[model samples]
Target chain A: GAGVSQSPRYKVAKRGQDVALRCDPISGHVSLFWYQQALGQGPEFLTYFQNEAQLDKSGLPSDRFFAERPEGSVSTLKIQRTQQEDSAVYLCASSLRWTGGTEAFFGQGTRLTVV
Target chain B: SQQGEEDPQALSIQEGENATMNCSYKTSINNLQWYRQNSGRGLVHLILIRSNEREKHSGRLRVTLDTSKKSSSLLITASRAADTASYFCASPTQGAQKLVFGQGTRLTINP
Candidate 1:
């Protein structure tokens, strides 16, 4: 319960539909990250937040992918007009430090299936 | 380019045997980390080796870093069936950005 928590461990969506995934990071963590992992592949960075500021979103595959951490605590990753390629396990991680060298705490992740 | 690439994409060994996995990165890194993921679960942080550190150990896990080679290796001694899972190596780029991951090595410890 002390670790990161993500909602709706599994989700099914139709192609061309929109979906929103939620992540509640450990309280007071300064760095939050979202990653996309395709089946049998490693997680790819999607975006990052240092508190409420989205410092980098270069990994977002397209404009259809958008993520926000409005209050710097809970974050949402919303995909608009999702396609089959968008199906993957969406992972959320948080670290106490704002830098890269620290170990991050991860959530169970939401496995999204699109058909 | 992928920041971290792991080799021998998969590994299988018997219980009580040792398992070793390798990883290489493309760019300079402040530190390298290893994680393990069980089926349908989140990744669990295994260890972190800084650029300056050559070797570190935690329980049955041993990690060695070769910054000159821009590579690292993870070893699990006296493996157990419970160790069966996917192991990944990740490196952090930029001063304070995020972690880039490798495809990971699927390790199976058969009894």
Candidate 2:
């Protein structure tokens, strides 16, 4: 693909429900990242993957938030038992570099609204 | 968790004026990168400055990195209304694969 792509641009979920957001990064990109952005705020890191390896997930807000990149190309972010506070835009970014310090390409993002 | 902090949470300036924003990081970093975000477009990478480099330029964007102080600044010359957006600085964390981004500086260009 030309750029990072995310599915279901917007989502509306009831409290206690589970939601899954998907991301398809650029072809062969080595690094992928997920972030949560609240209204009127910057994107906050959620997790990072280096070719299917979940190197760091310390940024995940709680145990309810989970992410996976089994093939290193497509990633999914799943939130269980969504709460009102879980309403935010979920962003996915991919970079060519194996490590950090490289320019990253971002998807349009998925806006999740938990009611 | 966020390691970088961008000063002057919001900025407003005339279209033709210059706009500047600063970022400070808590830990040492090998490099720092800047990104811009707006309602029309998603996040876009602007520039990156290595620790060894003091300054770098990409068209009208000038980025300076001071490793000793663990800080960086972005300057936009002759800003335009289209340049209005939120800018963020990010640095490597938990090794070098992931980045910890700042809260960001919201820039508004008035015509």
Candidate 3:
């Protein structure tokens, strides 16, 4: 793909339901990131992947929030027992390199609504 | 926690006017980046200024960084209605791969 791609642009789930969001990064991108953006706020870091390795998960809000990049190119973010506060836009970004000066390209985010 | 803080949460300006947005950060960074988002969609990379560089230009966009003051500013010259969007400043977290973003400045370029 020419850019990062996210699946199911929108999702609505029950308060206790579990939901999964997927991301397909640009071909051969070495770094991938996930972020959560609340209404009227900046994107908050959720996790990061360097290839298949999950290098950082400190930003995950809770135990229920999990992410994986099993194959290094495709990643999944799963939220269990979703709460109303969990409603936000989930964003995916990928960078060709992990250097400090490189800019990551973003995908159209998935808007999640927990009812 | 967010490392950067953007000033003037919202700005309304007429087309053809220049728009300036400022951002301040707490920690030292290897680089600072500016991104633009439209209608809550994906973000597009605008420009980046390294900590050592004071200024950079890309098309109609100009970015400046003051490492001494831990601040940065973005200037858009000859703004157009199409330039209306939210602009954010981001800095990479220390020892981390993720970039921490500021709340953002909502820029409205009215005709």
Candidate 4:
């Protein structure tokens, strides 16, 4: 129970609809990451937040994807005009820092389905 | 683009059997890490072997890194049904900001 937690384990949305997914990282973790995992593929990075500052967002597929960690602890990933291609498991991970060689903790992820 | 490639995309073995997965990467890495995902769940960290380390072990898991060959292998001895999952290898390539992952090897342990 002391691990990363993601809200709304499953989400179903109509095409073009908007949805928001939330993630609560492990307590006191300084770095949080957002990744998208399509069926039969590995997780791809979306955005990374070091505390409240979003340092990298190069992996966001499109402008429709927006993520914020206003308080540096709880983060939200909002997708606008969701497309069928956007239907994938969104995973949230946290670590002590953004540097390599650190073990990261992950949440069970939110499965988003758009039809 | 994927940074690593895992061979034999899937493997199945009986309980108590051994399972092996191999991963190859293109660029030099600071470290290589292995993770496991059960069904549609999140990934759990399994082991990490630095580029300089040739081999390491934890419990029934054994990891070997061959930097010269730019590849790595994971061996699970006496695997159990609980080990059924998709195993991914990730590398933090030099000067890369994020870890790049391989397609993964789906391992099934039949009871």
Candidate 5:
């Protein structure tokens, strides 16, 4: 792929509904990350994956927010019992490696509106 | 959570004016990177400065890092209407692959 790609660019969910966002990282990328951006704020870290290994999930706001990269290529972020605070853009980024400080390419993101 | 903070929540400037935004972070970092974003969109990587490096330039963008002060500044020379966007600074956590971003500075270049 040309760059990181995310699916379902926009989503509207009612309170307590469950939603899953998908991300297809760039070809051969070894690192993937998830972030949440609220209106008028910067993106905040949610989770990170080194290949298929989930190395960091400290940034996930709660246990309801689960992310998995089972095959090391495509990933999924699932939010259960969505709340109004979940109304934000969910972004996915992939980088070449965890070291060397390489630049990460970002996807357009999925804007989730919890009504 | 956010680790850095960018000053001047929002700024409006005329086209061709130089736009400057500052970011301050706590704790030590190996590198700092700047990004830009349009309204309700993904971020675009701009420039990165390693801890050893003090300043770097890319096209019209100039980035300076003051590790001693734990602060960095981005200066966009000859700003254009197209440059209107939100700018954020991110620092990767030690031994971690994730980047922690700042609050961001929303810049508007009026034409």
Candidate 6:
């Protein structure tokens, strides 16, 4: 793909419902990142992946938030028992390498609403 | 938590005027990068300035990094209506790969 792609551009879930968001990063991208952007705020780092290895998950807000990149190409973010506070735009980004100088390409993002 | 804090939470400027936004960070970073978001969607990469470099320019965008003050500024010259967007500055954490972004500055170019 030309750029990172996220599925279900918008999702509305009832409180406590579990929802899964998917991300398809650019082919061969080695570094994948997931971020959560609240209303009127910048994106907050959720997790990071290098190839198939999950090196950082420190930013995951709680045990309800989970993310995985099984094949190193596609990723999924699953939130269990979603709360109203969890409603935000989930963004996916990928870079060719896991370096500070490399540019990251972002997906349009999936807007999740927990009501 | 966000490591960077952008000044001027919002700015409204006339078209053709220059817009400048400043960002200050708490930690030492290897590089600082700027991103723009429209309609609160995906973020577009603007410019990046490494810690060793003092300034960089690309087209109408100019970025400056001051490691001593742990601050950076983004200047958009000859702003247009299309330049209206939220701008954010991101700096790498100790991990180097994970970037921490600031709250961002909402820039509006009134025509």
Q: Which candidate is the best by lDDT?
A: 3
Can you tell me the DockQ of model 6? 0.76
What's the distance in Å from true for residue B26, model 5? 0.4
- Candidate 5 scores a chain A TM-score of 0.98
lDDT of each residue in A28-68, candidate 5, tens digit only: 99999999998888898999999999999988999999999
The digit string of per-residue lDDT tens for model 6 on A1-115 reads: 7889999999999999999999999999999999999999999999999998998999999999999999999999999999999999999999998787877889999999999
DockQ rank order? 3, 1, 6, 4, 5, 2
TM-score for predicted model 6 compared with the true structure: 0.98
Q: What tens-digit string does per-residue lDDT give for candidate 3 at A10-107? A: 99999999999999999999899999999889999999999999999999999999999998899999999999999999999999987768999999
What lDDT score goes with residue A99 in model 4? 87
As a whole number from 0 to 100, the lDDT of residue A85 in candidate 2 is 98
**Between the candidate structures 2 and 4, which one is better when assessed by DockQ?**
4
Candidate 3, residue A71: how far the Cα is off, in Å: 1.0
Instruction: For all candidates, state DockQ relative to the true structure.
Output: 0.83, 0.68, 0.86, 0.75, 0.70, 0.76
Q: After superposition, how far is residue B47 of candidate 1 from its true place, in Å?
A: 0.3
Off by over 4 Å in 1: none
Worst-scoring 10-residue span by lDDT in model 4 chain B: B91-100
Please provide TM-scores, in order, for all candidate models, with all chains considered together.
Answer: 0.98, 0.95, 0.99, 0.98, 0.98, 0.98
DockQ of 5: 0.70
TM-score top scorer = 3
Model 1 lDDT tens row, B8-97: 799999999999999999899888999999989999999999999999999999999999999999999999999999999999886748
In the range B1-111, model 2's lDDT, one tens digit per residue, is: 688999889999999999999999998888899999997346898998988999999999999998888889999999999998999998876465677789999999999
Tens-place lDDT per residue, model 2, A1-115, is: 7899998899999999999999999998989999898887778888889889998897899999999999878999999999999999999999886466678899999999999
After superposition, the stretches of candidate 3 with alpha carbons farther than 4 Å from their true spots are: none
Error of 6 at B94 (Å): 2.2
Write model 6 residue lDDT over B1-111, tens digit each, in one string.
999999989999999999999999999889999999999579999988998999999999999999999999999999999999999999888755698899999999999
lDDT of 1 by residue, A1-115 (tens): 5999998899999999999999999998989999999999999999999999999999999999999998989999999998999999999999997577789999999999999
